[model samples]
Target: MMLSHYLIVSGILFSIGFLGVLLRKNTLVVLMSLELMLNAVNLLFVAFSRYNLSLDGSIFVFFSITVAAAEVAVGLAIVVALFRLKQTVFVDAFNEMKN
Candidate 1:
């Protein structure tokens, strides 16, 4: 696919992920949206790397994936802790921590 095509796809995926994050009430869905957004970014990076015929963007994508993996690990830990304390996966239930 061309760079523009990849960019469009990435944009759409990012928007969908943004909507999911904003509209979903469940904590798990929110986390998944974040992952989707990350993947979209990775796609964009790879596409640009191919377009430029350079390893820079691809190398960054690799680092991004690694960071994303770490993010998932920590995010899931927080989610598990929240579920244990609240007994529900709803985002609203986490509001008490705002203080």
Candidate 2:
């Protein structure tokens, strides 16, 4: 399709992901939402790359995916550790960290 179509889809995905991150209480869900947001950005990058007929955006997308993978690994590990300590993954339940 056209670049506009891709942009619209990416924007919608980003909005949904943003809302998910803002409204969810579970840390796991939040992490997933964050990934959703990242993917949306990746989608935009690829769309622009395709439109411009250049590899730069695709290269950026590759690196973004790599970084996102690392983030997921570290984020999940932290979530698991927090769950072990508190027996819950809800962000509200970890108010002890507020100090």
Candidate 3:
């Protein structure tokens, strides 16, 4: 309800997501972490907007959701391609991008 509460929740979620992204070797887990971070940011935006009684934060959140949807589409496609090529989903196996 309050902005501080939302911020604290978002901070915790972001930290957890960051840890997941750092510790997980699986591509899927990494992507899920990314989603977690995005959702945390969205929550912060919405809470700030409500606190300020303005619509801009909500508008930005809307755009962020749109962008996140597009990212999911492209990210999943790329992951699928990686799986087909590497026969694995481990992030450490992603050597194709190396020079």
Candidate 4:
């Protein structure tokens, strides 16, 4: 496939994820959407790396994957904690966390 094909796919994935994040009220769904967005970016990076014959994009993808993993771990931990405290996973329910 061409670079434009990869970019188009990435754009679609990112837009879907962005809409999910914007419209979903559930924290878990939002997290999954965030992961989708991250994966879209990774896909773009890999595509660029393949077309350009450079190691830098792959290296960046490795770090991005690491960071995404850490983000999921911490995000899920927070979700679990919030669920334990409030018995719900809705984002609006987290407003009390300020206290």
Candidate 3: TM-score?
Answer: 0.94
Whole-structure CA lDDT of model 2: 0.97
**Tens digit of per-residue lDDT, candidate 3, span 33-83:** 999999999999988999999999999998999999999999999999989
CA lDDT, every model vs. true structure: 0.93, 0.97, 0.92, 0.95
Residues 3-99 of candidate 1 have per-residue lDDT tens digits of: 8999999999999999999999998899999999999999999999999999999999989999999999999999999899989999888888599
Cα TM-score of candidate 1: 0.94
Residue 58, candidate 4: C-alpha displacement in angstroms: 1.0
Tens-digit lDDT track for model 2 on 1-99?
789999999999999999999999999999999999999999999999999999999999999999999999999999999999999999999887589
The lDDT, on a scale of 0 to 1, for candidate 4 is 0.95
For 59-87, candidate 4 gives per-residue lDDT tens digits of: 99999999999999999999999899999
Ranking by lDDT: 2, 4, 1, 3
- What candidate 2 gets wrong by more than 4 Å, as runs, is none
TM-score of each: 0.94, 0.95, 0.94, 0.93
Model 3: number of backbone collisions: 0
